[model samples]
Each structure stands twice: as C-alpha cells, then as structure tokens.
Target: MYKASCSCRMLERKGILCRHIIWIYSSNGVKTIPDEYVVNRWCKDALRSKSFNCNGDPAEEIDIIDAKQISMSKMWSEVHQTVGIPMGRSKEVVDSFSSLIREFKEKLAPLGSQMSKEQEMVALIGCSTTQEVTIFPPKKSKNKGSGKRLLSSKTKAIALAMKPKRMYQNDN
Candidate 1:
C-alpha cells in the first residue's frame, strides 16, 4: 500500500527502466514495460540493421587503406557532430580541441609509418601492380626557427659551469 515514485534517471542514464518502475508495474498487474520505455539504441539488433562492416563501410568491396580512412572519417565526423560542434563555439574548447588533435597526430605518426612499411612489404611480394606505390622524401621546413632556440648567454655560462670535469686527458 506504499506509494513509490521513480526519478527516471535510470531511464535517462542506462536507457532502461529501473526495478522500482518495474515493481510498480508488476504490482499494478501490468504484463510488461511499455514499448515507449524501451530505447532502440539499447536493443541487441540495433547495429545489425545497418549494412556497415567492422570498418564502418556500407560497401562490401574496399581496400584496407580506403576502409581505414573511411572508418576514421566517419568516427571523426560523428565526434565532431556530437562533441566538437557544440563545444567549438567557445575559444577554450577550440584551443583544447586543437591541442588534442596535435597530440593525436603526433601519436598516429608511428602508426602511419607502420602502415607504409606494411604497404611496402605488400608491394615487394608483387601482390598487385594496380596498387600505386609512391615514395616521397621527407620535406625540410624552410623556416629558420623550426627547432630548438639557442640558449641565452647567462644560461649557456651556467650550463658550461655545471659540466663534469674530465678525469683523464688525451694528448692525441
């Protein structure tokens, strides 16, 4: 004979009705939760309806690089839509996003090199001549201040003073 009211936060958070709601329904002689209460995203067959493969492509025929690029693009686009678009309105959000992208690019450089090595190996094995292989030399920055800046005179003097004394002298 007790009155119970659910906050419905479980429905909002987990996309499923809480036990309290279920109990209330059961006590009231309701056979099951209503169709409206069940979210499509929580359904087991939600992703199965989509024709996308593991690489997130609807098309069955696609190369590994193309598939990877397509999947990554889809992922980034989704992320941009969900998180970036709203947050991007603010300067702080834009700066944070730029930094995050810079760090991500730095981390992904090695993976890119690994993929290039894999492609080179595939080419060496003579799998397909249709696969175009182009090697470009690393481009040097034209900017004069591309790297570390020279230390100030005071800092250089301090560094020279901190240097360890040589134990042995070599005449040669």
Candidate 2:
C-alpha cells in the first residue's frame, strides 16, 4: 500500500483537495470528494445565494428603490446566466437570440416614434450645426531668419567646443 500525503497548500490556495490527497482517497475506494473540500463560489448555483450586506450578513429590509434595483439586477443576472452563456456556446442559440432582439427592436420602434417636432428639429440642428468661429493661422515671426541664424551659430559653436582634440596633434 503506497502512502500518499500532501502539504495541504491546495486547500489553502484553491479551497480544494490536492491531487495527492485525491489519489489516496481514490486508492482507498472513495467515490466522491467531500463537501468540506468544495468552495461555494465554484458551485453551479453560487449566485443563487441571498445578497450579503457590507458586514457580510444577509441584507434585509431594503428601501423600495433599492429593492426594485436589486430585483432588476437579479432578473438581468438570471437572464444572462440562462440565455447569454448558452447563446455564446451554440451558434443556433445565438441566431435565435439575434432574431429575437431584432423582433423586439422592431416592436419597440413604434413606441419610440412619438418624438415631438421640436425635439426632432433640435436633434437635427444638433447633428447638422457646426460652430463657425474663424481660427486665424499662427502669426509668422518677423525675426524668423535672425532666430534661425542665432540658433545655428549657437549650435555650431557648442559642437566645435565639444569636438575632442586629436591626440598627438600639437598646435604648431
């Protein structure tokens, strides 16, 4: 009988059993990993748990606005879990979702068509109107040639001063 032992770092790091421990259990005819080794966050229904407060306890007696927001969030989460994830996995599901979205947008178009003439005009004006401030090009300096000559003279002087004197070449 081969003895198997682990440093238990897997339990600390991953909240699960190490392969060494699993091997030992399998060799001893264990069928399933124990519940204590499983982390709730890794489970399928992890998000189905009750909402927790900042203090880490279950939240209670929220305001009406907060309750509505929470309900909307939960609905969105459920829809994403059920629809979005599956759609990503299957091309047929993705096509169906796309068609459903198109139909929904078409149905909603009439409801969104009640914009006032003033609102339409404002939107059109916003899109079409460009601010017409005259931007004068930068003024050309009157001393441009003098400035270039001064810069070139300074640079040439600096370069000549920095040039290393050739060794063994004495000034005659």
Candidate 3:
C-alpha cells in the first residue's frame, strides 16, 4: 500500500495523474479506497476538464451495427433461438407490415392516377385566361346612394377596373 501511494504521488508530480491519485486523495488513508468518494470526485472533475487524458487511444475503429443486414430469419433460427421471443408471432407481424405496405401502394396508385387526371384538368384551366372575355358594366347598382357619392376619376377608374361585388346579402 505504501509503495502504491508513492507510485501514485510520483505519477501526480510527473503530470500523469491517474484515478489512483484521486483514489488516494478521496480515501485520504493508507488503506481501502471508498467507491462513492472516487466516483463523486471523478464525476465533478470530469465536468470541468476539456478532454479526458486517461486511456489514450482506441485500439481500432469498429464498424457501426446495422439492423437491416442482420437477417431476422437467421437471428430467429440459430442465434436467438433460446430467447423467449416468438418467431411465429414476429413472422406474422413482418407479414402484416408487408401487407399494409402493399395495401398502401395500391391505394396510392389510384390516387396518383386520379391526381394526374386532375392535374391535366387543372392544366386545361390554368391561371392564364385563353380568350379575351371583356367584362361588361353591371346594368344598375342595388344601392341608389352609391353612385351619388362622388369619387376622384382615379378612384372611379380603379373601381371600374376591379371585379364588381355581386349583390349577395349577408345572413348576419
């Protein structure tokens, strides 16, 4: 224990402090290191430090796990056969999902076709008007007082250019 503490102190001086020095400081004794003290100190210290200098470099780069490539059938038949997961139920669920996808595609196909037709109709009736349909003036105004209220020629022209409001009485 004496030798270990000396070694830890030496490491601390050499700018190579390990968990052992923290362990020593935390326990503050020559005997056993308490787990809680070590954990608390390390956690608090870790938060302040920019990067962890401990455990230098990783051995090698490992490939990321892919669920798609991992054959569910193989996983069921051999690898995970011992587990309580019902393969039959899983298969049904997969099949059910496949059926749902198939149904969705079928429904979407008709909708797609209908949309294309509707798009064609919309193309036929685009925003641009085909024939120059001259807008005739309304024969008369329902409100007799509307004409009497004199407005500027510019205002009258703007009013004339705009689409006339239909005599639709409000229900309110």
lDDT of each: 0.71, 0.71, 0.57
Enumerate residue pairs that collide in model 3. Answer: none
> Mind giving the per-residue lDDT tens digits that candidate 1 earns over 20-100?
888888988888567778677877866545356433457553326667668989998987785546463788877777788
The C-alpha local distance difference test score for the whole of candidate 2 amounts to 0.71
Instruction: List runs of model 2 lying over 4 Å from the truth.
Output: 1-5, 42-107, 113-172
- The full ranking of all candidates by lDDT, starting with the best, is 2, 1, 3
Candidate 2 lDDT over 1-172, as tens digits, reads 3334478777777766788898888888978777766688888867664677443667765436677678979988986775655544678877887788789879889888677876796664444333585687889778646543445888889999999987896788
lDDT of 3 by residue, 44-151 (tens): 545443333223443343357557546755655774543334445778776776687588779878666555665676655543333565687879758756567778
Q: Which stretches of candidate 3 lie over 4 Å from their true place?
A: 1-36, 40-93, 102-172
Summing lDDT over every window of 10 consecutive residues in candidate 3, give the lowest-scoring window: 49-58
lDDT of 3 at 57: 40
Better of 1 and 3 by TM-score: 1
The residue pairs found clashing in candidate 1 are none
Q: By TM-score, who's the top model here?
A: 2
